[model samples]
Target: MNNENSKLTISRIIQAPRSTVWKAWSEKEHFEKWWIPEPITCKVVKMDMTPGGGFETLMSENGEEFQPHVEGCFLEIVPLERIVFTTVLTEGWKPNDPWLSMTAIITMEDASSGTKYTAEALHKNPEDSNKHLEMGFEEGWGTTIDQLEKLIMKLA
Candidate 1:
């Protein structure tokens, strides 16, 4: 992994508590509800909320189904404060190899009446970073986040 040239980070202040935000991510049902953008549906194949556990989510876009994009094991889970995971060679805690891997760090902190959430994705290289950027990283991630905000607010 060429860490020096690859990074994608986004932070948003959600109008909800840290617990709410954490539940939105840690719960399969809640995650599926907001993990995809409009016109795209996501199915959580499996989610084991523990370090070394695994997760996968299938996405269908515009009537076309795509294979799971994320197959990773959790590295850390710190309740409402942070979550760390990696998309490396693994399936339900089993190891294997395919494409590039990434470590995603999600942090949550109290912010007045809500929560300040930050997502930082570290990629393998500048090329991979550029590839993700070209794949609508801003729009896609932004929309998913918007969906999360809406879902949390609705439940709040």
Candidate 2:
């Protein structure tokens, strides 16, 4: 990958099957549970898991107020295998202005213990990529993934 278009990849092995993880990701109710860090509630406004479909969410510290956290479009979806989303476009392929446009590719693979999950955030430019890193992408993402693991484990 070129440095100009920086990409950050994070992966984990969850003690669950790909179907379980995919269910958590594909279902609105299940997704919101671990999509964000604790203390911050996540509301799934819209989720159409198909190419050119919409994916929107709101997050709020207090239940009273909710603000837009993610407004993106699904570029690709392979059941139980992979998902690709981008913030550059909204539902219906409408373009949107974002502080930093990026495409996120999430994949799931079978593992000896369970499932190997990976998330890759690809930025348009190095500056934006560095900005995400500076904004604690690793910590935030890792925490959310951990939360996901816990949820899956409990449900398992």
TM-score of each prediction: 0.89, 0.96
Model 1 score (lDDT): 0.82
Question: lDDT: which candidate is best?
Answer: 2
Q: Highest TM-score among the candidates is held by which one?
A: 2
Across residues 1-156, which tens digit of lDDT does each residue of candidate 1 receive?
A: 667569888889999999899999998989988887877888888688788887777888854676676778788889999998888745455665536567788899999969998888888788988888788878888888999999998777
**Pairs of residues clashing in candidate 1:** none
Query: How do the residues 16-108 of candidate 2 rate in per-residue lDDT, one tens digit apiece?
Result: 999999999999989999999988999999999999999999999997699989999999999999999999999999998876689999999
In model 2, residue pairs whose N, Cα or C atoms come closer than 3 Å (at least 3 residues apart or on different chains), thus clashing, are none
Once fitted onto the true fold, the runs of candidate 1 whose alpha carbons sit more than 4 angstroms away are 1-4, 62-66, 91-93, 98-100
